[model samples]
Target: MEKIFDNTEAALALKSDSELERARFLFELIKRDTLVKIGAAVTKFALKFRLPVEGLIRSTVFDHFCGGITEDDCLPVIDRMFSKNVHAVLDYSVEGKEEEGQFDKAMFKILKTLEYARHNKAIPYIVFKPTGFGRFEIYEKLTAGKKLTQEEQVEWNRIKNRYDRVCGKAFEYDVPILIDGEESWMQDAADELAESMMFKYNKETAIVFNTLQLYRHDRLDYLKELHQQATEGRFKIGMKLVRGAYMEKERERAIRLGYQDPICKDKATTDALFNEVLIYMIKNLENMALFVGTHNEESTYLVLQIMQRCKIAENDKRIWFGQLFGMSDHISYNLANFGYNVAKYLPYGPVRDVMPFLFRRAEENTSVAGQTSRELYLIKNEMKRRKLVKSV
Candidate 1:
């Protein structure tokens, strides 16, 4: 079978020899279990005690995984990716903030991102987490059908107003906004709010996107329900489909809280569910705009196969592929090379504030079987092909 994601040269073309060498070293460290454990531990301790390790992190993983510490810092990366025909999605990745002031700040930054994106054709969309605008506990309470106190109610209203301002700006600029998925406990509120935004702004087309995590056993059904709602409500649907990021956290919480685990039974099941949703969305492309956000080779192939079967154009505006900025250049660059609409989820924030995001990337590479190994293999191949390596 011909694979769409096998173009190692195209994948690594944007990376300089030194960048590839650094990536190789990073992935090499990630592939070693003991080293990853020790590095993670040391990183945690250093951050806790205010030790000076930001420079080391900024040079290595942060540079690789994140755009930079601010929106302005992301411009060179955006231009570089756009030069390769890959678009960018600016994601403000600061997490675990709770104060109303912090929420307002996040909203301000996102609005600025949208304003910037309005002028930059290289950026297709902007994204933020719901928790970025409000407290997680409040979202959990709302999701659980619990009543909020008077002060909490006021806080909830403020969160909604923040969302409205951002989405309103997105609507004004004619740029779509993606609301990232969160843990299942808080997802219900996020989903409801996302739908409300869609209903308000998506009457003409999908301006507000809701991410669907297919690793959850119920998400396929949720997709079906949402499709029905869209049909009846007379609005276009925008969706970014992924295999889920918070699988371990969801399962651990379910176990500790004595609730059923929300994740699919295994990787195979998740893959099946993801492909099923992809097919469904493609079949209904008239009312749906889809973003395939996965690094899995088979899933990428499945999307190509389905698009071909459906006679959808390679550069259809309603369909796009997304991968994280640094992890899956093979997929992003290869797809974009073929004239497909592709974007990199470029995350940016202060280094210290974005450590949670960086640590998750490190842990994901270390824990996911073959993830780091595959990256290492591709980088080494590209290096050898360029004769950047004197000896193997």
Candidate 2:
């Protein structure tokens, strides 16, 4: 396994004592009943900072969650990972837009990232959210089966052109781009757009990767349908699968609308679907390019077994493993050691908008079983090994 459980190494190398202690403290704080309150304080502090959080957010969260403040600036980390045989998917985490100018700026930033990736061997992929460049309500209406108004359609076309530019750059440079999934309400539209892009650019290679949230009960079926469509169309299908993130919102909306929830009934259902789809892809590797993005040990190993069973090489270009930048060192680092293609989804941006991303990670750690406990356990172990006594 090459000791993928080297979070202790990543942590000790990247975080100072105060930074590690703060992570440990936040680890403790997030577990208590006062989590929301602690979250509020963290948000307040993040807003008070400058570009990077220098000591607090940058040293801990940014160091853990992002490659760097800028795409080019991330070279050291990117080089380090590539030296370990891990690749990267660059994510610009600017969010909550309300202006056309902001949208243009976001597009410019992403295009710039794509241009930079053309020269960087380690950066094979880049990701962006539709919400970053299009209005959420506009997409919700389109995905809700509503006809778009003239202005909305025009706006949609422009936003889509921005996507085309991103994909076109990727196609030009022979790099791949992964379009992130959005809210359940807007995912259908995202999928349609991503599918269209894939058909356009992925006729030869898997360049456009659409995210599939298996937490949705229908996505496995959707993956099957998409695979069929891609085969019939003679195009390669690319996918990044995750246990969906917005469970509470999906459930609440379903109940409010009095519809059967589209999400899986439980985590087990989602996990089962994820592994099955992964196996299906591994078996049909040539027709599909797979990015197995998860932290669960079995799911990660399940993909490994699928590749092995299918006689797929460890360095197969069609399959890669991924986990979010901050959270899953053991998965990515270890998988890379096994000579499999693996990467961290490294998010970078200014502090304010990135706070939402940060907050979500914290809450997710609290929600996921043993996530915090394991992190706490690791930090304490490393600290004790260093003979440093910590408070609480």
Candidate 3:
């Protein structure tokens, strides 16, 4: 098998032969299409039948992906990440509806995460979605830059209050809250709202972070403009760079509307923009705190090189590396091992509510470049080192 990292010394620094053997066994299981199919089917059936799978899910993917069902429940896993020098971005993964009650629940949850984060040194950040507090359609409409009704405007005000409470709580606790990126149709509103919150809450420090999706053709430049705007306002900017989500939907919508697609022309273009964004952020490190959330080796390496050239500290508060909890342990653990600030976006919720997210992860791995293959290969390498494979 072709090695993704020929520098095996660097790659294997943290894992022993025994660990590698176990990884190989898991890799073989991950590589099988059958495992995902059976897993998804069982999960789907459990949801349909309303059978309890919390115990099973907790032992399987939940253990792999989530922090825990609650704050106190997550400490053991949080401590594990800390042992590896990985920070925790505790996520309350319960999706909220548009109703006022649900919005209140989400706000309370964010506040709770902040309160809990206050006492957890390993957890410096948490994430929340605007949709957790508002209707998607309302944000989609607002993104069209259309005028909103009094009622809609009032609702927007209430949404702002929700975020203000969350951010304030985080700030009082000296933790940060990341506002997640959402679908393109509603992304504009999300961006605008986050910026408004940043300008308000980011006065003394960057307490709120806005995720920027680089796949959009205009966003790289938009990031630059945002830098200028932040400079002008004299407020620190925080950005989390992601290649994108919603690619297929964006393409389909563009085709259906007889319009140019907003996405980059190709994956290479997206990658180029991602690296450029990192470069810009590194160059202006004082004015911005940047988080690179990627599994791409090239992008991750590029950030390291840039930081080295600029003599930035590995533990610089303005920079972070993040990976989803269940994936990319190599990058996360190794970088953390190297004394850089790294984090795992550890999500938590009940099984049914989180299934939507879980299924999407499985689907994405199956389609994404080198993801599942890479995962499987690493697992296999570990297993081989362990001599765990049975004779044919």
Candidate 4:
């Protein structure tokens, strides 16, 4: 309420002049939809053919957007952010693996992060994708209410087991774990699985945080229903509320498959849905905890105002403000500077394995109205405030 986010020095305190320049250049490129699309295509082609582009990619976007290529690789970043009081959520960013071996590998990777979190206060949480632990087709089939073959059922059971293994360890370590939301078709089954984990592990506190992609119109109702069930079942609900990342995919698929589009009608509808759900969860803070993940300034301020109105301490453990590692520094760092609980989603993996995640980040920046430009503006303002850039 005191206009804290405008403090460029505090917002970019951790960034040196070189890092600020790099962020400016990257956001400038991301502002161009055509350029981002062409870059994504060319990057995919380069990675596909094993061209010698990993170093270039690593020096640029990878360093900006991700912590590192491995858990050990991320240590400096984790330590530096925690120096500013911003916590990290170690995310293994590898995507789109269908093999059982790959699933097991992802599970092991998360288990390693949980171990890291057990010893490090810098990492307050760890996260995983539901599909990362199992096959997407299995989740889709289960969500559709279709019968699974014996082998498919076995795969599904294995997926559930993977969830339990990581979640059980999280409970043991006393670290909160976040499960990311995926596209609508596959999310129902993942939601059910996350609910079961919460019911099992959240009896004392919220250890398992399921994602709510509020861009979907039905997610508010889903939250209400889940809340009712959570209350009656005597378990706490931990949720990561996001504006969603798969809007284009969701809409195109709905049109192709002749089903109602699961997305809100437009940006306004999605924004309203996100805020409405935020308020709903805030009101029920006794039984529910929140990880408010957004790049929108208005919504971030809204959360601050609500916390003040509810007399919730800025450092409340049950509530946190989260943003991506490479984006929204003003929101993440400034909030942390104000004694608020804040975490950045620190995505990391091998360069090739993480390309898909990077592509989506670029596409999301381009598609979201004003997001890229706002980032550019803030970075430029910060640079000028630091005397690294000339005033217009």
Largest lDDT belongs to which candidate?
Answer: 4
Model 3 over residues 1-392: C-alpha lDDT tens digits? 12234333344445556545554554455556678778788888887898987687666666666777777778887886687688888888776366988898988988888877888889988899889978887888899889889999998888878888888787778788899887888988888889988888888888899998889888877888888889889888999989887787889998998888999999889999888888888888788898888988889888888888788898988899898876777778778767888988998877678776776666556556777787666655554544543533
Worst lDDT 10-window in candidate 3? 1-10
> lDDT of model 3 at residue 311?
86
Runs off by more than 4 Å, candidate 2:
1-23, 41-55, 384-392
lDDT ranking, best first: 4, 1, 3, 2
Show where candidate 3 strays beyond 4 Å: 1-42, 52-54, 388-392
Best by TM-score: 4
**Which stretches of candidate 1 lie above 4 Å from their native place?**
388-392
Q: What is the TM-score of each candidate against the true structure?
A: 0.97, 0.90, 0.89, 0.98
Q: Over the stretch 1-392, how does candidate 4's per-residue lDDT look in tens digits? A: 68788777888889988999999999999989999999999999999999999999999999999999999999999999999999999999999888999999999999999999999999999999999999898999999999999989998999999999999999999999999999899999999999999999999899999999999999989999999999889999999999999999999999999999999999999999999999999999999999998999999989999999999999999999999998999889889998999999999999999999999999999998898887888899987777854443
Superposed Cα RMSD, model 1: 1.7
For residue 313, give model 3's deviation from the true position in Å: 0.8
TM-score of 3: 0.89
What TM-score would candidate 1 get against the native? 0.97
**Model 1, span 75-174: residue lDDT tens:** 9999999999999999988888878899999999999999899999999999989999999998899999999999999999998999899999999999
- Which wins on TM-score, candidate 1 or candidate 3? 1
